[model samples]
Target: MYDSILVPTDGSEGAEAAARHGLNLATAFDSQIHFLSVVDERSYSSALADLDPTVGEQREGFEQQATEAVECLEEMVTEPPVTCQTAVKHGVPHEEIRSYAADHDIDLISMGTQGRTGLDRLLLGSVTERVVRTSDVPVLTTRHEPDRSRYDRILIPTDGSEAATAAIAHGVAIADRFDSTVHALSVVDVGGVVGAYDAGPGIPELIDSLEEECEQAVTVVEEECENRDIDIVTEVVQGPPYRAIQEYVDREGIDFVSMGTHGRTGLERYLIGSVTERTVRTSDVPVLTVR
Candidate 1:
């Protein structure tokens, strides 16, 4: 379903890993691939130039690095059937990426969750986070080398919101392509509920109600998979959503994860706290997020 894929690089180990995964997807879909490297103009602005005499040289060096980054990604495309292109832009990294995707009608934007300069393990890379939060298109992110290009088992975490529905469609499409088993999971977020309000006599009934809601949430995903004749396993689990998802991935040997950037709010906002962000930051495999 991905006709055009975009891989934004910074010549980092993390970016290289993400590019390799993007190349794998392009091969599977026969999709055209575009590699983009952006030089942050803020690094060489006039204010910095006023303090440093070598600002001109720094700008040129940044431009060259950006050019080389995309060139490296372009070299990764060895398959003759997959078309590839490259470009370098001077702007904020995330903005340049978003503009390029929109301008080129990119079907997917895949990149590293961490940039060349590693980010804090607890936080997503700032640029990558900005792109994920703002981009209209789906973004796929990975922080480490991918073990295998093909996704044999895909996990879809849902919270029964419009955002979750969008994620389901993308996840199912990819699973259909790879003939992968789909795992549909919904978390009861007991921790969040107890933290937000008083845990009194009504807590048991509340948990039961939340579990039932979780079941219904995953059932929608089950129905969608059934329509496509795809094998799906559905479950409703109780815990912190992101932790539950990570546990599920490990227990099931899931190779990929797809979920929404946002979901239902309030006590049912199991998919909030940017659960997608937390998952993207910590997942061993690539996480594809749809808005």
Candidate 2:
């Protein structure tokens, strides 16, 4: 699993946190890691616009800066049981990174996020968010410092949908590699109950029905874990889907989160982005989004 992990760094502290996590994963799996620092042409255009240099001179310096950043990142990486490769490219960061992953056949993409940045106003998605949309492989991303307790437990969030099931296979592979426990959770979307709204006399029946549905959902997860030797914990929470997940992570002390993208295409992308973006934007632990 993850024979070659690719990490895109922008020399930000958030990226530094993710780089360290990528290194640790490489160490665990004895798999190679690639550290790529792409210098976006847009950033260059903004910074060097007033330099008053010839176009060729600007390109030379941009290329040189990209090279130097990659070298600096390489020097910062101290631990590696697996081989590490470093390179830099010039172009739109997201598109260029996606193409690099495609050309190199990267197994998994590891990236860092700023946690608060959602979709950019101009672009449909954030750069980190956009790659997850386009990447054909799994993506493991972290915005916060990784908890070093050694991934003793992983949390899998599912709606019992087809895409979520596909996500579990990738997550189980990670658990098997790390010898960790896997916990599965189903969140009932009870957001309608939240707010200053009023409920009728049938409220009790609605709650009862929702609870029963949650129980059935948890049962499915339990059955999936029954044949495995790894310890599995299952839970069902009632609230907005995102709120339930965020609360569970804090309540259960989850080390990492494994989630599925509906693999929504065309118009559905806006929908898929809502769930994943909220999770990545809020989760304190690492998140692996499987498509």
Candidate 3:
């Protein structure tokens, strides 16, 4: 379904790993590959002050790195036999990424969760997290390079919200393209409810309520996949959401997880953090976050 794929590079191992997966997807779908390198102008002020007075050494240095990074990605694109384009822009990395995708009609953006030296350790790297939060299109992220073949099984986690339904559409589209199986999973967070209560008097009723929600969530996926004639298996389990997703991935050999940024749980839950972001941080497989 992708027409053009964008890979933002910073000449880091993490970015290179993401590029590998992007190239593989581009090849599979016959899509063009676009490379972007944004020079973080904010990082240059102090360094520029120390450079030679007559020379614009810092700016030139950043441009050179951006150029080389894109060139290296271009070379890597040959095996896939797809057209490749590159650009070096100077601005905030996440803003530049979003702007480039819009201006260039990029269908998908594949990136790494962490840069060469990302600042955040407790959450997703700054630029990536921002892009995931704001991008209008799907953003695919990988912690490590993915296999060069089709995804074996794609998982779509749902909570029956509009955002989750948006993810379900993308998941089905991708699964259709690769002839892959779709795993529709909904986790009832019984642990979350139980942990809030010191005593277990109302826990069973609460668990039952959550289980009903899970069933409805899974039904959303089931209906979508059914309409598309895509093969799908559905599951509803009770546990912590992120842990349940991770365990499901390992148990089913899931190679990709496509999820929404916010679910039926709403913005408040995402404001604190999200199961989606946590999964992105911990999933060994690639994640495609759709907003």
Candidate 4:
């Protein structure tokens, strides 16, 4: 369903990985690919005084670097034969990316969760984090090299919230495009409940209730999958949501994860809960965050 896919790069290893994955997706959808490398003008200007006579030359050098980074990505697009374009923008990295996506009608923005330096603290950079928080479109992030093979299994973690519903649409779109099987997971946060209460006497009943809720959540995902004519497998378990998702990804050989950046319950549960933040930091494959 993606029309124009944007891949913002800074010539980092992480960005290289994202470019591969983005190209794969574009090839699959037969969509146009746009490679954007934004020059952080603020960083350059601060590092080199604007009053300096050489400052203009330094800016030109930065633009040249951006062009070279985009060319590298373009060279990698030959195997699947996707239409590719490149651009260099000057501004804050995240804002430039968001603005380009909006102005260009980009369907998705695929980026690295980390950069060469401290741009990304752990999972993603401040720019990536801000884009994930504010972007109107889905943002696909990768911390590892892309598998390249068509995703055989795609994971969709849900909590039956509006945000999760939005994520489902993106997940189903990708799964449908690749003809991949969808695994819908709903985790019961029994640990959260136990932490909130001192006694374990009511833990069993609470766990049971959480499982019931999990079932309802997965049912919502199942119905969506059925509507899309995509194959689906469902699971419900009791544990910390992020751990549950990571464990499931490893256990089931999940190639990708699609979920919301924030959940309807706010900061309480997984699938955009704190769990999403943790999962992004630790996931071995790409994680797609839709808001």
Candidate 5:
């Protein structure tokens, strides 16, 4: 359903990987691709002394880097070419990204969870996390370069909340486009439930009730896939939701993951950090998060 896709880059290998995936989607949908690189003025302004002679030079260096980054991605677009555009802006990286998407009427934002200056750890790059948390549109993120032609299996994890259900249509749309099998998963947070209360006589019955809820949740997804006449598999598992999702991806060889930015317990402003944020931070495959 994407008509215009935006790929924000910092010229990192991670950003390049995301660009490749964004290009693949653009090619599939005959969509226009916009490559944007943002020079984070704060990075230099906060470090250098006020009115320092080097400050202007540092800003110019960053702007040049931004231009080069977009140009590098532009060069990658060829052979059955999709429409492409490029731009560089000076601002907070995440704010500039959101503004670009809004100003360009972007349909999808595909970006990397890590960048050249990213924290070398399991957490997502700060800018990417901010965009994912606050963006008003769907965001597709990845940490590794993916096989562009290999969206053969798509996973959709659900918790039956309105937020979780909101992701199902997007997941199904992508599967429909790729002719991929849909794996509908529901994770029961046994540990969270148990820890919230005493592990006493009522626990077994509570667990069974939770498992039934999980089954019903997956059933909803199953019905959606069936209505679309898409091949589908459904399952219910018990664990921390994000860990269960990662395990399922590894076990099933999932090619992509689609999830809601928030879940049943999500706060109004914060994402369900333990689940969606963790999955975005740690997923080996690309994740499309819908709010």
Candidate 6:
């Protein structure tokens, strides 16, 4: 469980949406929320050279905006007794975010992204992707768009693997908290085997056995969630893991994807390299990845 959450806000719509979810998480754990705004000092410094000698007003404007951003978030921290704290620092956004989280002993970081893709993302270099990749702690991220399902439906993507179960436990808690229904998904990497070759003798039995295996595997996961009284819905899909999860999220109108980090680098989680990394990088909705 998280003890304290750090959220970076640029006052953009994307960041505002993330703050909404961040509050829910902070409330869940009775955790304090740290809101930070980075001044993009590199850009500011470059602009400074071109500013008028009487640029004092411009500097004051920056201070005023930073204060407004912090106060706005403080007002929003109405639930979970979130002890809202804010700081404005001058630096690159991602570096400032990572460094602050490290120094403050932040339990989790929740931030927003535009969810850029392909060339756009390649060109701009996503801050969310970088932070998720480099940060020592877990990250839950959101985009600018608001999700309508919020408290009604939650999605948990599983693979019937031990790693996937990590999300199941957390997902049940999430569903219970919102009094919402839980939909459990296990995406098998069956595409390769299915599309690879021609049928052989007893292929029918093999196919039947495979289907049964999928059912039994997913059933155990669903039953565990049922114990928590979270109305359970289950699905078995075939494709690449990340693609299947993303497609299921889109098709089922999922509000959130709670997952786990299977492999941790070491005690400090100083390094993490897994498929979850790839999924978080591509997911469009908010993701809660627990280790």
Q: What does candidate 1's lDDT look like per residue over 24-112, in tens digits?
A: 88988899999988888777775676677698777777888888888888888887689999998877778889999999999999989
Clashing pairs in 3: none
- Per-residue CA lDDT of model 5 for 130-164, tens digit only, reads 99888988899999998666699999998887777
The list of candidate 2 runs beyond 4 A from truth reads 44-57, 76-80, 115-125, 192-220, 263-272
Q: TM-score each candidate.
A: 0.93, 0.81, 0.89, 0.91, 0.91, 0.71
Model 3 Cα shift for residue 225 (angstroms)? 1.9
lDDT of each: 0.87, 0.70, 0.82, 0.83, 0.84, 0.68
Query: Between prediction 5 and prediction 6, which has the larger lDDT?
Result: 5
lDDT (10s digit) by residue, model 2, range 198-286: 66776666666666755665566566666565678887776666777788889888888888876334311211457777887767898
Error of 1 at 201 (Å): 3.2
Give the alpha carbon lDDT tens digit for every residue of 218-284 in model 3: 8888888889898999998877788989999999999899999877653112111378888888789
Instruction: Please provide, for model 6 over 1-291, each residue's C-alpha lDDT reduced to its tens digit, 9 standing for 90 to 100.
Output: 677899887666666677888888777678889988766554434466366644545555555665566677768887556788898876676898899999999988887766223321210227776787677777787764455425567787664555456667777776887787788776545543455546566555554555565576568768987787768888876556567777888888777887766632222111134557766666777887765
Q: Positional deviation of 16 in candidate 5, in angstroms?
A: 0.3
Query: Which residue pairs in candidate 1 collide?
Result: none
Q: How many backbone clashes does candidate 3 have?
A: 0
Report the Cα lDDT for candidate 3.
Answer: 0.82
**Ten-residue region with minimum lDDT total, candidate 3:** 264-273
Order of quality (TM-score): 1, 5, 4, 3, 2, 6
Q: Residue 267: error of model 3 in Å?
A: 12
Give the lowest summed-lDDT range of ten residues in model 1: 115-124
lDDT of 5 at 73: 97
